[model samples]
Target: MSEFLRSRRARLRPRDVGLPEYGGRRRVPGLRREELAQLAGVSVAYYIRLEQGRGRNVSSAVLDAIATALRLTSAERDHLMHLARPVSRRLRPVARPQRVRPALQQLIDTMENVPAYVIGRRLDIIGWNRLARALLGDFAALPPEHRNLAWQVFLDPSARALYEDWDAKAADVVGYLRRDAGRNPHDPDMASLIGELSLGSPEFRRLWAAHDVQDKGFGGKVLHHPLAGRLVLAYETLTLPADPDQQVITYHAEPGSPSAAALRLLASGQEKTTERTLSCSEA
Candidate 1:
C-alpha cells in the first residue's frame, strides 16, 4: 500500500494541481514533500515518514485532509482510509454467485420511475431492470467477464462516446475499482479483472497506476445519448443490508427537467418496442 501511495502521489503535477512550483530542477513528477505537506496541513517530516512506511498508523482525519489535498474522488478517499490501516488478518474468501433472491428482483421490477441495477463488489452487474438496460444498453448483454463497470468504461469505445464528461467518468470508474481491489486484495477475480483491463486499455493502465480509490456513492452524471442527444441524471447507490457485497444504483432526473421528460419518452418507447418484439416472436 505504501508503494501504491507513492506511485499515485508521483503522478500528480504541482502547477496543474494548484501547488506553486518552486524555482529549481526536481527529480520527481509531482508536488514536493514540503509542498504536499503544506497542502495537506502536515509537516514535511510527517508526510515523508508516512510515504516511507515508517508511520503506519494514520488517523482518518489526517487521511481525509490528505485525500482532499490530492483532489481524490469519494471512492479514492475511501481507498486511502482502507490503506492507512493494516490489512485484516481474518479476511474471508470471496463469495460465489447465487440467484438474486426473488424478493430483491421484485423490488427492482417495481422501480418504474427510476433506472436501477444491482452490482457485486467485483463490479459485476448481477441484476437490473428493463429501464437500466435501456439507459446503459447492451453492455450488460455481454459475457460476465466483460460486463464489469471498469471494463465497459475503458474497453468499450461506445462508453467513451456515451459519457459527456468521459475523462471524469473514466477516473471515477478506475478509482472505484481501485478501492474494491484494496478491500479484497486476495480475490482472484478482482486481480484478473485488473490485469485484463491493464493489458487491454492504455487509459486503464495509466489510471490504475495512480492508486486512486473512491467510496461508491451518489453523484450526478451527464450522458450523450444516441437518440436523446444529451441528458443529465442524479445517481444514488444503496448497499443491500441482506446481501453483503451487492449495491443498487438508481438514476433520477429532476421533475419537469428536459432530462426527465426525455426519460419518460424513452421509457414509453422502450415499453412499446418490447411489446412489438414479443408480438413478432409470437406471430
Candidate 2:
C-alpha cells in the first residue's frame, strides 16, 4: 500500500492540481505531504503516517479526501481501497496449471478460422485452439513455466520473432504482472516469479519498477509469423464470469485483407498436415 500510494503521488505535478509553482524547484514529483495534507484537510503528520506505513485505523473520510485531491479514476480508486483494506487470500504457485472449461474449449474449436486461447491468473496459457497454436506457437510443447505469456515474451526466440513490436508488448505483459503483484503481495509464487524474472532480464525489472496497470480490452496487433509472414489482427479479451481470473482472448483478421488471406493459407496447410498424420496412424 505504501509503495503504491507513493508511486501514485510521485506521478502528479504541483501545477496539475492548481498549486502555484514556486520559483525554487521542489524536490517531490507531486504534492508533498504538507501540500496533500492541506488539500485533503488532514494534518501533515497524519498523512505522513499513512504514506510511511505508520498509520492505523485510517478513516474513510480521509481516504475519500485524498482520492479527490489525487484525482484518481474510479478503477484506480478501487485499487487503492483494495490495497488499503487487503484480506488474506489463498496462495497459488505462479506456474500452477489451470483447467479450461469444456464449453470454452468447444467454443474455440468451433471458431476454426480464428485464433483463440485461454489465459489464467498468472497470464499462463491454459488452453488454445489449433489456429492459435499456429499463430502463437505450440503452447503444449512448452514447459509449464515457459507457457506463461510474460516468460514467453521475454525468453522465447519464437515469441520475439512473432511480434512486430516486441518491446511494447513485453512491457505491457510486465505491467500486468506488476499489477497482480500489488494485489497479492503475500503470495510466495508471485514473489518467486518476480525474483526469477528480475534476475533473468534487466528489461523486465525496468518495466516492473515502472508500476503500470492496464485492464484487458480490445486491441489491434501485427505479427510476423514464419508461415503467414506479416499478419494484422484485431483481438478482444473477455474475462470469464464464472472465473474472473481466467480470460479468453480471440484474434481475427478483417475480411479480404492480406492478413485474412494469410490466415486461410495457414489453416489449409495445418489441415493437410493433420490429414496426412491421421492417414499414417491408420496405415
Candidate 3:
C-alpha cells in the first residue's frame, strides 16, 4: 500500500496540481508529503501515516479527498481501494495454470469472423481461434514464456509496428498488470514475470514503477496486419464466471466496413469449423 501511494505521489509534479513549484534538484519525483497534505486537506502526519500503511480503517471521505488531489482515474481509484482494504485470503489464489473450457473453445470456434483468444491471469495466451491466429499471430508458435500478452508487447519486434499507437497500448498493458499485482500480490508466477520484465525491458521497468492502474475491458484497436493491411476492430473483454482469472477477448469489425471486408478475406479459404462454443452473448 505504501509503495503504491509513494509511486503515485512520485509521478505528480506540484505544478500539475496547481501548487507552486520551487525549482531545485529535488530527489523525490512529485509533490512533497507536506505539499500533498495541504492539497488533500489532511494533516501532514496523518497523510504520512496513510502513505506508510500505518493508518487503520481509513475513511472513504479522506480517501476521496486524496484521490482528488492525486487526480486518479476510475481504474486508479479502484486500485487505491484494493490496496487500502485488501482481504488476506483473496489477495492471491494458488498459482495454477488457467485453462479454457470446452464450451469456451466452442464459442471461439463459432465466432468465425471474430478474432478471439482466452488469456490467463498473467496475460498468457491459453487458447486462440483461427481468426485470432490470423489477427494476433500464432500464440502457439511462441515459446511458453513469450506467449504472454505483456511479454510480447515488450519483447516482440513486430508488435510496435502492428499498433499505430504503440506507446499508449504498452502503457495500458502495464497499467493492467499493475492493477493485477495489487490484487494478487503473492502470486509467485506473476511476481517472477514482473521481475523478469523489469530486468529485461527498461520501458516496462519505468511503467511498472509508476504504479498506474487500469481495468482492462471493452476497447477498440487499430492494427496493421501484414497480409490484411489496416484493420479497425472494436474489441470486448469478457470474463468467465466459473473462472474469474480467465478472460476472453474478441474483436469485431463494423458491418460493411473495410475492416469487415478484410476479415472476410482473411477467413476465406480457412478451414470450416463445424463445432462452436458458448459465446459472449450466452454469457
Candidate 4:
C-alpha cells in the first residue's frame, strides 16, 4: 500500500495539479507530501501516517479526497480502497480447484468461432473452449500450477511471440495481479506466483513495481498465431456475478474481416482434430 501510494505520488508534478512552482531546486520530482495533504484537505502528519502505511481506521472520505488529489481513475480508486482495507486477513489456500459451472462451460463451448476462457482468482485459467485452445496455446497441456495468464505471459516464450504488443499485454497482466494482491494481501498462492515471476522475468519485476492499477474490462489484441497467422481480435471481460472472483473473457474478430475468416478456419480444423482423436480412442 505504501509503495502504491508513493508510486502514484511520484507520477504527478506540482504544475500538473495546479500547484505554483517554486524557484529553488526541488528534491522530489512530484508533489510533496505536504502539497498532497493540502490538496486533499488533510493534515500533513495524518497523510504522512497514511502514506507510511501506519494509519489505522482510515475513513473512506479521506481516501476519496486523496484519490481526487492524486487524480486516480475509478479502477485505481477501487484499488486504493482495497489496499486500505483488505478483503481477507490471511486467506487460506483454496483446497479445491476453481470450477466453471456446467452451463457456463457449455455456453462457451458452443461458441465455435469465438475464443473464450474463464479465469478465477489469481488470474488462473480454469476453463476454456476449443477455439480458445486453438488461438491461445492448449491450456490443458500446461500443468495446473502454471495455468495462469501472468505465468504464461511472462515465462512462456510462445506468449512473447504470440502477442503483437507483448509489453502492453504484460503490463496489463501485472496491473491486474497487483489489484488482486491488494484485495487478498495474504493469499499464499498469489505470493508464490509473484515470487516465481519476479525471479523468472526481469520485465515482470519491473512492471510489478510500477504500481499501475487497471480493470481491463474490454480491449483489443493482435496475436500472431502459428496456425491462424496474424489475427486482430477484440475481447470483452465479463465478471461472473454468481462467482465474482471468476471472469469470462471472450475474443471476437470484426465481422466479415480476414481475422473472422481465420477464426472460422481454426474452428473447423479444431473440430476435425477433436473428431479424429475421439475416433482413435473409440477404436
Candidate 5:
C-alpha cells in the first residue's frame, strides 16, 4: 500500500494538482507528504502512519478523499481500497482447480471465426477454442503449469514477435496481476508465478515495481500472426459474476475488413502452417 501510494504521488506534479511551482530546488519530486495531507484534509502525522502501513482504522470517507486528491482512476481506487482493508491471518484453504463449464465452452466454440478463451486466476489459460489455438498457438501442448498468459508474455520469445506493441501487452498483464494480488494477498500460487517472472525477466521486474493496477475490459490490439499476417483486432473481456476469478476474452476484427477475411482463411485451415508452437521456455 505504501509503495502504491508513493508511486502514484511521484507521478503527479505541482502544476497537475493546481499548486504554484516556485522556482527553487526541491528535495523530493512531486508533492510533499504535507501537501498531499493538506489536500486530503487530514493531519500530516495521520497520513504518515497510513503510508507506513500503521493505520488500523482508516475510514472509507478518508480513503475517498485521498483517492480524489491523488487523481486515481476507478480501477486504481478499487485497488487502493483492497490494499487498505485489513487482512485476515487465517490459513487459506487449498485453491481448487478452475474449470470452464461445458455450456460456456460450447458457446465460445460456436463463434466460428473469433478467437476466444477462458482465463482463470493469475491469467491461466484454462480453456480455448480452435480459432484461439490458431491465433494464439496451441495451449493444449503447453504444460499445465506454463499455461499462464503472464508467463508466456515475459518468457516466450515468440510472444514478443506475436504482438506489435509487446511492451503495452506486457504492461497490461502486470497491471492485471497487481490488481489480482491486491484482492488475493495470501495466494501462494500467485506469489510463486510473480517470483518466477521477477527472476526470469528484467522487464517484468521493472513493471511490477510500478504498482500500476488496471482491469482489462476492452481494447484494440495489433498482432502480427504468422499464419494470418498483420491483423488489427479488438478484444472484449467478460468477467463471470458467479466466479469472479474467471474471465472470457474474445478477439474479433471489423466486419468486411481484410483482417476479418484473414480470420476466415485461418479458420478454414486454407493457409499453410508456418507458425511455430508457443513454448514457455526462454529462448
Candidate 6:
C-alpha cells in the first residue's frame, strides 16, 4: 500500500495538479511531501510515517481527505480502504469458478428477456444464459483464459469487430480493469492479465497510462450484433451481496425501441438454435 501511495504521488506534477510550489530546488514532480500533508490536512511527520509504512492504521476520514487531496478516483478510494485494513477472518471466499452456483445461474436463466451475465472480480465471464450469449456474441465459447472482458476487448478479433464503436468500448474495459487492479493489488491473476495485455496491445497500454478508473455499477453500451445489427443497450450491474466478488450485469433497451424488438428477435433465434443442438445431442 505504501508502495502504491508513493508511486501515485510521484506521478502527479505541481502546477498540473493545482499545487502552488514554494521557492526551492524540488527533488521530484508533484507536491512535495510536506505540501501534500498540508493539502490533506495531516501532519507532515504523520504523512511521512504513513507513506513509509511505519503506520498502517488510518481512520476513514483521514483516508478520504488524502484521497481528495490526491484526486483519487472512486476505484483508488476503495483500494486505499482495502489496503489500510485487513479482511475479516470470518468472511468466506465468494464465487469460486468450480461451478456457477445454481441460484445465481437460475437468476440469470430467468432473465429470458434481458441479456445478462455473471462476472468475477477479475472481470472473468463466469456464466451467461442464452440471451446474454446472443447479445454479447460467443464470450462463453472462449477458453477460460480468454474469458476476461479486457482480453476479449483487446486480444479477440471477433470482439473488436463486433462492437460498432470499438475505441469507446476498449477505453471502458481498460478503465474498469484499472479500477479493479488498484483495489486488488495483491491479486496475481489480475497482475498477470495486465502484464500480458500491456505487452500485447498498444491500445490497452495507451489507455492504461491515462490512469482512469471506474466503479462498476451501471453504464450504457452500443453493440452491433451480427444478427441484430445496431442496438443501444442500457446496462445495470448489481453486485451479489452474498457473493462479494461476483456481479450480475443486465441489459435493457428503451420501451418500443427498434433495439428492443431486435433483441427479442435475436433471443428467439438463439432459443431455436439451442433447442436444435440439445435435440441432436440427446438423439
Report the number of the highest-TM-score candidate. 4
Task: Give a tens-digit lDDT track for model 5, residues 37-155.
Answer: 98899999999999999998799999999999999999999999999994665755566789999999999988878999999998899999989999998899999989999998999
Q: Evaluated with lDDT, which candidate comes out highest? A: 4
For model 5, state the Cα shift of residue 125 in Å. Answer: 1.0
* Candidate 6 lDDT by residue in tens digits, 99-143: 569888998898888998888877888889889887886876678
Ranking by TM-score: 4, 5, 2, 3, 6, 1
Candidate 2 positional error at 106, Å: 1.4
The CA lDDT of each predicted structure is 0.80, 0.81, 0.85, 0.92, 0.91, 0.81
User: Please, what are the lDDT tens digits per residue for candidate 3 over residues 1-283?
Assistant: 8987787788899889998888787886888999999999999999999998899999999898988898888888888887888767665446665778888899898888888999887888899888888788878788888889999888788999888788988998998888877777667789999988888889999888777788869988899989899999899999888887789999999999999999988876354432323343366
* Steric clash pairs (candidate 5): none
Reference-based TM-score, model 3? 0.83
lDDT, model 4, position 213:
89
What are the RMSDs of all candidates, in order? 4.1, 2.7, 5.6, 1.6, 5.3, 3.5
What lDDT tens digits, residue by residue, belong to model 2 across residues 1-283? 6777777788887789888766578766776777778888999989998988888777788888888888876656766666676655544345434799898899998888899999886677898998999889988888887778888887777777899998878877876776566566676767877888888888888887766665646888899998799999999998899887789999999999999999989888878888999999999
Looking at model 6, residue 7 earns an lDDT score of 59
Candidates ranked by lDDT, best first? Answer: 4, 5, 3, 2, 6, 1
Candidate 4 collision pairs: none
lDDT of candidate 1 over 7-62, digit per residue (tens): 66777788867866777888877767787788899999999898887886688888
Q: How accurate locally is residue 225 in candidate 3, as Cα lDDT from 0 to 100? A: 89
User: Residue 279 of model 3: what lDDT?
Assistant: 46
- After the best TM-score superposition of candidate 1, give how far the Cα of residue 265 lies from its true spot, in angstroms: 1.6
Note the clash tally of each candidate: 6, 0, 3, 0, 0, 0
